[model samples]
Target: MKDLLIKNGDLVFTGTDFRLVKGSEQLRQNVESILKTSEGEYVLDEDLGLNRENILGKGFDEELARTDIVEAIGQEQRIEEVSQIDFEKNGRELKINLKMIEMDEEELELEVDLDA
Candidate 1:
């Protein structure tokens, strides 16, 4: 899959031309987008993204959070399996570490932080 490259919430450009993201990089971007979005926020696909309202709170339940995050990440079609997932919470910030295998056996190690 190929998509317009985005960096820091903006499209990438070089020499007045936009760049494209493909393969693993594209998958990574998708996963990151999924993680950062709140459930029901995407107009076209309300099913996509994590349930931020439930996932973020003073009472942080690791198990439930893990399940929800895994479920959200699974929405990406390129992912074949989810491996290790670890979490660290600091005040209102959430840090997530994940390892997953893609459909073509490509591995992805990602770190996602949520400050919502």
Candidate 2:
């Protein structure tokens, strides 16, 4: 798959055109988008993203958050399985680091940050 690259929630422009990404980069970006978006935010796919209430609130359950992460990513067809997943929180910021193994054995290392 190919897509216009987005950085910091904005489309990337290079001179008179936009930056593009494909293959692993595209996959990485897609996953990042999934992780960053709050569930129910996208109208067409109301269940497409992570549930922020689970991972970002006062009574946060790590396991439930993990389940939310897995379930959301499962909707993505390109991923075979997630090998490793970790979460670190500092104050109101959450950092998610994961290693995904694709169907063709291509390994992807993705890190996503969200304000908790």
Candidate 3:
């Protein structure tokens, strides 16, 4: 029952090859409209709604950015696979496995495997 409201949020596509895309930061700010748009825009569809009883799993990226402290300390952390997010694109369902390393509340830095 946690409600997350992202204001002026930037969405990224975490693909197998670590391919990133500017996902609809240019689209309307109204979150409802954005969610209803096609997956080509990289927005999660209706089935992915926060209250839809279909949110597979969730995690927090507490310290979203790589800071000097983190580098200095070299804290050992692993990118755990949270869940596979599937969305419709061109009449086909595409799956993207989400992996996250919890940071703080600054920004959400999703872990992308460069060596896919």
Candidate 4:
């Protein structure tokens, strides 16, 4: 693994309520800080919600949803809707559709469609 070299395509998260920017050192700093306080694996979606996992295959779950209120309730509906957002590395395909959900929440769904 140490001998492996790779390239990471830029990941940009944009939405009506929140944006997890890419190529910003400031954002990287913030992310690093948050990761320090976090346990397990996590992924940032278009709505900037952090998905965390205790084990490897726990799957993505909304840990925090974007909201105007820091201490708000029932406002998870404020995020932009996401119908289908998928990414497959071995299959080399990416598809996204934002019109699936009724709510305005953003969904950054990423998946790997690998073949055995």
Candidate 5:
């Protein structure tokens, strides 16, 4: 799969010049999107995102939060299985280490961040 490269929510190239993201880079982008998007935010796919309602402010349980995120990733067809997950929380910021297998049997390690 290939997609236009996006950085900071904007296309990385101007008119007539396009940067494409392919292979592992594209997969990484998909993973990032899954983590960054809150459930119900995208009108087309209301059930296709993560539920981050309990990740911010008070009543934050690391285990529950990680479970939610893991389940969200599991819902994606491209991911075959999640082998490992490591979460590091600092205030409203979170760092996640993920090891997963793709549908094609490729194993990948990804790092994702969330800021509440």
Candidate 6:
């Protein structure tokens, strides 16, 4: 599958040409989407996002955040297993390290940041 490339939540293009994402790039895009979207944000796909209910309150729960990430990503059929997840919080910033195996048996590692 090919899609218009997106970076930092914006479309990426070169001059008059639009950049495209494919293969592993597409998988990375999918993973980003899964992490960035909050539950109930997409009207048609209500269950198609990460649940941030626990992270929204005053106190941050690392366990809840990890569980939410695992559960949300597990919903994607392309992801076979979430092997490892590490969370680090500093002030309002949250960093996540994720290791997973795709349905094709390919290993993937991703690091993401979120504002808490």
Using lDDT as the measure, which candidate wins? Answer: 2
| Candidate 1 lDDT, 6-106, residue by residue in tens | 88889999989999999888898899999999989999999999987656888788888888888998898779888988988888888999999999898
Which of candidates 2 and 3 is the stronger one according to lDDT? 2
Q: Per-residue lDDT of 1-116 in model 4, one digit per residue for the tens?
A: 01111113233344533333332233223332232222233354333422223212323222232221111212233323434333322232222111222232333322222111
Among these predictions, the greatest TM-score belongs to 2
Go through the candidates in order and give the C-alpha RMSD of each one to the true structure: 1.2, 1.0, 17.7, 13.4, 1.7, 1.3
Q: What is the full ranking by lDDT, best candidate first?
A: 2, 1, 6, 5, 4, 3
Off-target runs (Cα >4 Å) in candidate 5 are none
- Candidate 5 C-alpha lDDT tens digits along 14-58: 668988999988887888788888888999999877899767766
For residues 1-116, what per-residue lDDT tens digits would candidate 6 score against the true structure? 79889998999999989999997778778887888889889999999888988766577787887789989897678889989988787777878888989889999888877777
Candidate 1 yields a Cα-based lDDT of 0.88
Q: Whole-model lDDT, candidate 3? A: 0.26
Q: Higher-TM-score candidate among 1 and 4? A: 1
Report the Cα lDDT for candidate 4: 0.27
Candidate 3: stretches off by over 4 Å:
1-91, 104-116
Candidate 2: what lDDT? 0.88
TM-score of 4: 0.20
Q: State TM-scores per candidate.
A: 0.92, 0.95, 0.17, 0.20, 0.87, 0.91
lDDT against true structure, model 6:
0.84
lDDT of 3 by residue, 16-59 (tens): 33333233221112323223232244454433312211212232
* True-vs-predicted CA distance for residue 96, candidate 3, Å: 0.9
Q: Between candidates 1 and 3, which one is better according to TM-score?
A: 1
